[model samples]
Target: MDAATAWLVAAVSLLAAVVGPFAAGHALLTKREPQVATAWIAVCLIFPAGGALLYYLFGINRVYTRARKLVAEERLPPSLAPHPTSSSHGIGPEYAEQIRISDAVTGRPLEPGNRIQVLSNGEEAYPVMLEAIEGARETVMLSTYIFETNTSGRQFIDALSAAHRRGVDVRVLIDGVGEYYTWPRPSTLLRRAGVPVARFLPPRLIPPQLSINLRNHRKILVVDGQRAFTGGMNLGDSHLLQSQRSHRVADVHFLFDGPLAQQMEAVFAEDWAFTTGDERTPPKRATPHDSGALCRTITDGPNEDLDRLVMTLIGALSAAREEIWLVTPYFLPMRPLITSLEAAALRGVEVKILLPERNNLPFVHWATRHILGELLHWGVHLYYQPPPFAHTKLFVVDRRYAQVGSANMDPRSLRLNFELNAEIYNRPIAEQLALDCELIRARSRQLSSAELGERHPAERLRDALCWLASPYL
Candidate 1:
């Protein structure tokens, strides 16, 4: 061979030797699923350079390292310190295990004396939130997955700007991907008004971090560090009942008071600190109440605490006795959750799930359809809510316990993105949520086993293809 040809061959061989084993070894060590590891190894062996770059940018979990460092450097105020024991929170002994597991996962104790108000839709939630922002005496913190620049978004912008002008400490955090929903991002408006704002994991090309998959999906709003609002509602005109928009969505949100609100503030503070590198003092504790509802805040993400929401759901489902009523926009749960739901059904516990008939994301809807046969065969009832899509996420167990938050039933909410939910041991709230589920079910069409099995062959093939992409969807 010529010298030039020989030199080229040697370079290619060196590149292969270096990239192939490195990517394979990294995948084997880091990837928990064997299929994922095998896929990475094959890509690395066949297309060495591109595969190595893809693995570096997307496969590796870089957030853990940064999150761990920040967590270690963070100092909690005396008010936010962990309590000695979370056992005596007035939660029944039957729920002792669920409470303990949640505390272990979130590192936040179950707090009592919490007063929760269920806001039926954006009309109810937005007014209360704006009022709280206007009356802020100390600080206002807001975080959301989507902050569209529409009529409702402008209202929030004005309220926040007015609060900032009044010398209230106003800070806002919007997801990097969610800010592109409109021509001018809402963060720009907030910044123009001199409100402190930061985008979580904004898109970048230099470092090549494909952070688009990892989003901050939590919808949280805290005012004066004592009261907070959160759930699935985002800042968009579609959420308004009077919006003339073609597509509108209905959702539920909660306004919280007492110590549970403090926990919500802590989640926002840590996220803000991580994004801006700004140290934050723990929020002051709200005045304790002698008697009220019991609640706990559960935060989960791909950072240090991973798959926490999934684990918590599985645990709750396994322990459910009478019935499970779940409502979500998306419905693509992991294998373990599916198994737990099946088990619950086998034991004669009613398992009913409510999902939007026409989801905003067509691919996700198709994927969810592919799994319905299995669940239906196992005696789990599936109901589809007819149109003007519903974005609410809620779960009620035995009409006595309930969980509501921004997390959906899909893998994105379970294992990929950052999510927060409130677990309530209050019978009144659970009953109200159950009634809401009943209302949704009243408008929903339940699919029978035979109906699910009657899907056309071509449609089934399409659904199967979409189901294959569920892990990343």
Candidate 2:
């Protein structure tokens, strides 16, 4: 009622009104996703100060600025540049448009003469990785999202330490958040053993440079620049066999030999440079193998290359004429990806998606089930694989193109976390992957429209609530 109190209230109201629209305008300008932008704008308008602070802390595009600086300052060899005539590679005229799109997005060419060998789980991949590390003549580069100090992790640590002791240039990078599995992280163990190790974006609260959300989820290993391994397997006991454990995790990993390996190495080198601030000379290009496998490496994250992987997937789906088979542990596809799949299905393309029966992350499982009804309604067959929780990330299109790597279908892998995948244009590899998919499908239970319709009301409500959080899941 007093004039002074009225003046104070009026000033505060005026300030909030001015600040709210400014923040909302900033969100509208920066956010690419219409839904995200609208949500942020509404929040900024309704909550003002609190919304502005939250946006300042979490909504800004910090990664893109840092990534641009890193890329600009990092000196890379000319050999890492895209090949000029790679467009003419034997991807067929039908896939030419997709290839061009991929090339423009990734700045990498379709490399030919690469040989790929699929490795199933840690049982198959670990021995080969250890052997390659032991035989390393010059350098060994290893990076993974999770590097737990468990049985398999210890073995890897030993191999890497031994390699370092033998004077091989060994560098290891592990995700900071993932390294907290044990008291002394695997990176610490490697560092104690004199192996050079760096943690990607360790937790920091003061300067606030690191992020727990934007993780490095890529799993890559290159030995001597000649052989490389990558896929869904991380360094942990969970991935390896333990007789006492009844349920285990299954995944698909791959070994690459030839020119494609160099591209993989280039990715590792770039990450290493970004983390350690060390200038790296490009690794020698591996000789092309006799095999005619044409492959290209695709890396995506929330940085400058945001949505590249999802765009690549959409392009591949649009190009598919016969079939699309995808296997992932988690499934929370973006709107564009879902639309692409629906369009492909409408065009008579067989769209089959296989997911784990039970996921380690319960929230992700619930969120994934939320989208099944729409997919099933659109003629996109959904299959739930039986347990031992398959964590394989794979995609095969038209029995002529295949992709395998560390990315899941969720927002975390596709948009938030750093991820890598290899696209193969070889039919033999694609056929083998297709056969593997079939074997998995034989054990999976397909979800029909009736099955989804029969879900309990409470379960449906839970799924809807979980789906609401899919952007963060």
lDDT of 2 at 139: 94
Best by TM-score: 1
What local lDDT does model 2 show for residue 319?
Answer: 92
Residue pairs that clash (backbone atoms under 3 angstroms), model 2: none
Instruction: Give Cα distance to truth, residue 132, candidate 1, Å.
Output: 0.9
- Tens-digit per-residue lDDT, 333-445, candidate 1: 98889999999999999999999999999999999999999999999999999988889899999888889999999988887788899999888888989988999999899
- The local distance difference test score of each candidate is 0.85, 0.84
Off by over 4 Å in 2: 1-25, 44-53, 72-83, 88-91
Query: Per-candidate TM vs. native?
Result: 0.93, 0.91
Per residue, candidate 2 scores C-alpha lDDT tens digits across 47-149 of 9877876776567556666676446243322243335756666456866766767776777777888888899888899999999999998999999988878
* Colliding pairs, model 1: none
Separately for all candidates shown, the number of backbone clashes (residues 3 or more apart, or on different chains) is 0, 0
User: In candidate 2, where is summed lDDT lowest over 10 consecutive residues?
Assistant: 72-81
Residue 279 CA displacement from its true place in model 1, Å: 1.2
Error of 2 at 30 (Å): 1.3
